[model samples]
Target chain A: MTEKIVVAYDGSENAHDAVNFALSIAKAAGADLIVAHVLEWSPYSFLTKTEVEERHKRRKEELERADKAIVSPLLQEIQSSGVNVEVMVKYGHIAETLLAIVKDTGASQLILGRTGQSSLTSRLFGSVAGSLAQVAPVPVTIVP
Target chain B: MYNKIKAPVLGALASCALAAPAAASNIDEAVNEVFANSTGWFVNFIFSPFPGTTFPWIVAWLVVAATIFTVYFGLIQLRGFKHSIELVRGDYSDPNDAGEVSHFQALATALSGTVGLGNIAGVAVAVGIGGPGATFWMILAGLMGMASKFTECTLGVKYRNEYADGTVSGGPMYYITKGFAERGLPGGKPLAILFAIFCILGSFGGGNMFQANQAHAQLTNVFGDFPGWITGVVFATIVFLVIVGGLKSIASVTEKVVPFMGVLYVGTALIIIAMNADKIGWAFGQIFDGAFTGLGVAGGLAGALIQGFKRAAFSNEAGVGSAAIAHSAVRTSEPVTEGYVSLLEPFIDTVVICTMTALVIIITGQLVIDPATGLYVLNESGSIQTVGGNSGVALTSAAFSSAFGWFRYVLVVAVLLFAFSTMISWSYYGLKAWTFLFGENKVSDLSFKLIFCLFVWIGAAASLGPVIDFSDASIFAMAVVNIIGLYFLMPIVKRELTSYNARRKTGEIKKFK
Candidate 1:
């Protein structure tokens, strides 16, 4: 069985670099490349009863929007590489969801973008890469 | 009997009573009479005097509720105490969770209302009339009240509603209606409506009027006597400014203010207790001795028990369902976690803060305890005056001042801040209920606020008896409806609790911290 590589894609320029890096890593290792997109979501627990209903509607719209606007096109563009690839889109903490996917898919390595968030924000919140590096079950490669 | 009222104020009140009786007096007294008489029906029914004792059976309602919950939940208040701390510390909080505030903030806002005059004056009054033994019962009731708080807040969060604007509405109203609907039970709407009415009335009475009334009392003590309406106007203006219109952002700022005043008040109690460290044991001895014996008061043990439970119920308001409004806004997926966190409120308000106030009063020896009769000596005016011959805030003032002369000034500020913040919180609480009853619109909202402000003026300028009576009546009345709802919805809460407990045990509920 071929080893698997996971790419954390968000449609940002650095995400393109990450997909390319994962694609190359998959080729060199003769592995399958899995593109994973995490749509940011809150727990939705704060919403009022009325808001909760509307939030569900918005959340569906958001999932569809994320797939159509970013994930679908990105997956199609990457498919031209002609390597065996799969795409997964989910919602939750970006790094956590990506890590979970890596574990579930038995991926050997994970590649994500560096500095998608603003410098000040990443400094304050800590970079997602910085966090996943410490917790990921598999090795993480943050492509700049 | 009327000595606490100044002679001049008495003259003025008498004149107002005399002048109003013919024309406006009948209408005023009659309206008061209707509410006074009718609410009493409900009040008397709930608080019927216990047979062979002066204590009301209604106080037993909360006591029983607390006890049943304590046992039913396997003493969750104790078992969950450590987790309560962790939950509050944000160990289980996910920032992305749907909530308008954090655990600490919601607790602070709710605490802002509860940790006010009740801790300062209500405790003093209980100890004075019920003796130190009242302190024992008060502590017991507060501990037990924790379980009541847990049950209500869990239901509160479970039944809360989140709106599209990211604002959430919770508390007893939502729980009563939604919980019942979910359970396929009837009477949820009517019970919710009754609770809203009492809540709004309570907001106007205890939250608005009583606050201004006491603030005026303390103001006069510090700054010398001025017409209370003047202080009322100042307080009303501040309340209106903070409560109405924009700058709605001050809520977060005010949340911090409550804990500050609480710490200040509790810190003062600690210092005084330390100064009289030797008296600490003696104070506890008095408390224990008095509790069972009622210290020779009219009702004895029963009387002390009554006063303790009644005042603790009044102060912490654990079962009254107000704190659920605040706690429901907390950012946690597990509603039961909010329950665990909110139970800490009564523990802090009554058990810690109120107990400190009680201990300070006891250790300071400010209470004029009559050893011969085991009764507290009434002031020269033949009125109930415990601290330095002044009841209410003055009594608490005297207890603190006995240790540090300057502490009274601090006490005065603390009282004022406590009263002020309590009014602010109650304004929001009342507005929520008002909107629930009268439709949430600018007109109803403004009108309710306008009426609330008017009461601030009326509260300052009026006598304490009727206002405080209404306050006590309405607040306790809220308990009547709220406790009823709690009974119906408790099974649902149990389901939530059991599920959360199982998930927590299995580590499915991961702690971020």
Candidate 2:
């Protein structure tokens, strides 16, 4: 049985480094690598009735494009490396969605990178890796 | 009981501060001079009295519109009042619906813009000029204006434009243009341009300056005669910081502060009213008497009616079409639902809060009715002399301080907060109108905001008369163009209302919670 490991990816340079760090560990342990990307979403806005109605369409197109543009290319590279791999995209706060995917996939471990935005934004929104480390169901490895 | 404890305490302070300052006299003069000049002839033309009566035809314009909307909608304000409450409470709200704010939030935001100084000071002015009788007509107008709000806001949502970037803009401008195109009518573009022009001007006058002017008056009353320009500078800086951040900062502050301040203002008025519980009957009697006979007030029935309708229009802003812009941003699939939610605005603002201010003034004996003449007392200089010695917010401050003695301090804080928040919100409204005219570029945005901030200072330093006259005229000008568009768009609103009502009867508009 291949042990499950989930990599929280955001398509950043540091996130790519974390993916490589996770790959070596996954290869060593012969585990399935599940790459997850959580989009940051805050719905409170001042919009007109029409803008809001069309937001549904815009949100759908954005999610589809994220998969086609960001996740699909990565999925091909990982699968070609001859390791069991899959990609997941969820829309919500980053840390919470990553943990949710971990529990749903029954992954034994979580891996992600320390984004360059760790200064003020992480302090304000709470850093993804910092949050996952605190309450993640599995052990969290944050590649610096 | 406190009379025994307070007699000597009052005597001790009376001797300590027996003289008043000379700057106090100059402050009022300078402000009044600027006010008269700023408003000038344009306002005089708009407010010019009718040939046979003292009432301005502008008053008749709003009253007639409110009455027509009431009749055409089959008293929809009354019919939909209950559903309106439910809509605001989010009974029919869908989480998946495309909206930036909830119905309650939209109403609260819109209410903040209308409810501020107009409720506190404008009511005092109306009662001062027209006597307590004006309150009767004011209440009637508020009730009628509910129907007008229902008409304009409903159409505001139905004809809104949803841009490709998931941003939306709606108002009389959008509906005037689009609704006309749909009906295959001409002159929509010109009407839309006219509405935008007036909307921008109205934003500067009533929505910005009047608020700043009154807030400064309240502050100067408590803090002594600092240059009005100094107060203007302080207020302008705060407004700049907020509006410069765009909608994000405005949205955050208005959502929290608007409702709290509104409740605080109403709560204070209720306490004053309750304290004078004995005078409630007399107040009501005075209002009724004044409404019909005018009790020998200068212009009699015509005077009271004119001031009542004019102030109520300024206070609640039903037909001026500004509320439609605020209401259009609510999250709801049904446009009529927003209309229902918006009608509560005038009710809370004019019918409830405004009436409370009028009651406090009357109950506190602030109007000074003359027993011999059965009219307001005339000054030694042969001018109308109000009980508080002046009109506007000063009259209201006197009314409140008569009861609490220290309530002026509380009122200054309230007025300042009200003025600052109003400036920030009106900046967004003005920007929307500005961009509609000047294209939505960075330079256009900066220039409009710069002009808006400068007006904030000008408003604070100016006198009550000119600021108010200009504000009233500019806001009324918006109604001239907007109401014309609304006349053409009412059939569309009727069709939408009928369809929504039929669907609501079958539970197609389901309650999620």
lDDT of 2 by residue, B330-401 (tens): 546789988998999899999999999999888988876678876766565332466658678889998888
RMSD of each: 8.8, 10.8
TM-score of each: 0.74, 0.76
Model 1 lDDT at residue B401: 82
For model 1, residues B287-309, the per-residue Cα lDDT tens digits are 88888876665467887888889
Q: What is the DockQ of candidate 2?
A: 0.06
lDDT of 2 at B18: 29
lDDT of 2 at B308: 91
DockQ, all models: 0.06, 0.06
Once model 2 is optimally superposed onto the true structure by TM-score, how far is the C-alpha of residue B39 displaced, in angstroms? Answer: 3.8
TM-score of 2: 0.76
Every candidate's lDDT: 0.77, 0.80
